[model samples]
Target chain A: SQTIHQWPATLVQPVGSPLSLECTVEGTSNPNLYWYRQAAGRGLQLLFYSVGIGQISSEVPQNLSASRPQDRQFILSSKKLLLSDSGFYLCAWTGGYNSPLHFGNGTRLTVT
Target chain B: TQLLEQSPQFLSIQEGENLTVYCNSSSVFSSLQWYRQEPGEGPVLLVTVVTGGEVKKLKRLTFQFGDARKDSSLHITAAQPGDTGLYLCAGAFYNQGGKLIFGQGTELSVKP
Candidate 1:
């Protein structure tokens, strides 16, 4: 069984502060990872995705960035948080293209 | 940009009622998936349809992929309050390495 873990299930940060969210998967290797953000009453927005270590693709231009340090470890970071950055951030992994994705519990980030 | 549009952005119905949620797209996809998400939790994979015109059943839920692979639908029979949550549809193209483009989710509330 594959499982994903995300840290800081809930976060509260002041404006202009740095942000770091981590996601790790177990029972899978070299799986594709993705980062998504969902605002209240809005659809999810894909922020970034990584195919392999040191490979990251930004889906939309935003204040966030992503990195794949290890095969199953992905991180989402921001140098300075913005009020617009507040939302539910989700991490997902899939075995390959066309495959269903498994997601982590997600992190509720509130920027004040 | 590839985009997926979901209809009835919000739905509320009685527990014994039936409901159908639709996902539409102008571009064809290699595969499409349906997911259910609870508040404060990540979306869980419900089903994935790979072949065009494919239909899959998961207990009380039935999923169908359009013949052109440009759309899909999920039907729930005898919905329960436990089914209340956000439903999302995602599509994957052949060359995208399984990266998914998500739809504007449909929030369903099944009341007892």
Candidate 2:
């Protein structure tokens, strides 16, 4: 069975600080990886998705960026955090077209 | 931009009642997927509908895809408190490498 791991589970950072969130998939190779953000209790917003190493497609233009260093390793980074950047972050992976997505537990980031 | 609109952003219902949620879009999708998420956790895949006019049932839940492949609906019978969570619908385009575009999501609260 394939599983996704994301960390830190919870984060608290001051404004204008740098941020780094990592996601990894096990039991799968060259899987498509995605990053999403959710508001209070509502829908998810697509942040970035990677098809392969060094290939990233950003959905929304914001203060965040994504990178795929390894086949199953994805990272979400921010040079300086904004108040609006705080939310619930999720990492997901899928095998291919028409496949179900598998998600990680998520990270709750609070920017104060 | 290709977008999905989900109806009734929030729903509160009593136990044993029935409810339906809808997802609509003008752009055609090759496939659509439904997901359920609990508080403090990532969303989990419930079902995927690929063929137009296709219907699938999982226990008390029934999902239907429109004939045009641009819409879908989920109906739940005898709602339970365990069903209280966030429901999301996502659409996948053929050329996006199965990248999914998510709707705003529906928050369902079933009171026991």
Candidate 3:
């Protein structure tokens, strides 16, 4: 079975602070990884996606960035956080095209 | 941009009642997926419909993919309180690797 692990699960940071959220998948190799943010409790905005190591496609222009260091390890980072950056962050993985995505528990970040 | 619009942005219904949620799009999709998210957790994959006019049933939940692959519907029979959560519909393009377009999401609240 495939499982995705994401952390810190919850985060509270000050404005202009750096941010790092990690996601890893087990039982799969070279899977497609995605980063998404949900605000106002509905819908999700795609942040980034990776099909292989060292390759990342950013979906939106924002302060946040994503990287896939290893085949199953993905990281979402930001040099400086904004008040609008706070939301529910989710990490998901899929086998390939037309495959259903499996998501991690998610991280709730609050920027104060 | 290819967008998926979900109707009835919010739904509140009594237990044992039936409800339907629709996802519409002007663009064609190779596949459509349904997900359910609980509070404080990531969205979980409920089902995926690939072929046009395909219908899949999972317990009391019934999902249908439109003939043109431009829409989908989810009908829940004898809804229970446990079914209360956010429902999301995602569509995938043909051979698009892992890129998925998400709908605005439907918040369903079933009162027991």
Candidate 4:
């Protein structure tokens, strides 16, 4: 069975502070990874996605960036956080095209 | 950018009631999927409809892909409180390698 993990489950960051969120998947290799953010009661906004290590595509140009350091390890980072950056961030992985995505628990980031 | 539009952003119904959520798009997709997400958790794959006009059933939930492969719908029969969650529809464009464009999502609340 495949499983995804993300942490910290919740985060509180001061404005302009650096931020980092990590996601790891087990039981799969070379899977595509994605980063998404959701505002309260709103739809998900795709931030970035990676096909392989060191390859990332940004859907929205913002303060956040993503990196695939390993086959199953993905990281979302920001040099400085903005108030608008506060939201629930999700990490997802899929085996290939048209495949179902499996998601992690998600990180609730609060930028005050 | 390809966009998916979901209808009835929020739905609240009593247990044993029936309800339907829709996902519409102008562009054709190779595949479409439905997911359900609970509060504080990542979305879980409910079903995947690949072929146009395809229909899949899981327990009390039925999913249908449009004949044109541009839309889909999920129907719940005699919904239960455990069925309450956010419903999302995502589509994979042809040759897109499963990079999904997500809909705004429909929040469904089934009360006992």
Instruction: Give interface RMSD, every candidate, in order.
Output: 1.3, 0.8, 1.0, 1.1
Which candidate leads the pack in lDDT?
2
Of 2 and 3, the candidate ahead on lDDT is 2
Model 4 TM-score relative to the real fold:
0.97
TM-score of chain B in each prediction: 0.96, 0.97, 0.96, 0.96
C-alpha root-mean-square deviation, candidate 4 = 1.1
Q: lDDT for model 3, please.
A: 0.93
Q: State the lDDT of candidate 1 residue by residue for A11-101, as single tens digits.
A: 9999999999999999989999999998874567889999999999998888998999899999999999999999999999999877788
Q: Name model 4 segments beyond 4 Å from true.
A: none
Model 2: per-residue lDDT, tens digit, A1-112? 8888999999999999999999999998999999999999788999999999999999999999999999999999999999999999999999988888899999999999
Q: Is candidate 2 or candidate 3 better by TM-score?
A: 2
Give the per-residue lDDT digits (tens) of candidate 3, residues B1-96: 788999889999999999999999988898999999888898888999988999999999999999999999999999999999999999987655
Query: Which ranges in model 3 have alpha carbons more than 4 Å from their true place?
Result: none
Q: TM-score (chain B) for model 1? A: 0.96
Candidate 4: lDDT over CA atoms? 0.92
In Å, residue A82's CA in model 1 sits off its true spot by 0.4
lDDT of 2 by residue, B18-94 (tens): 99999999988999999999999999999999999999999999999999999999999999999999999999987
Q: In model 1, which regions exceed 4 Å deviation?
A: none
DockQ values, each candidate: 0.78, 0.89, 0.82, 0.81
lDDT value, candidate 2, whole model: 0.95
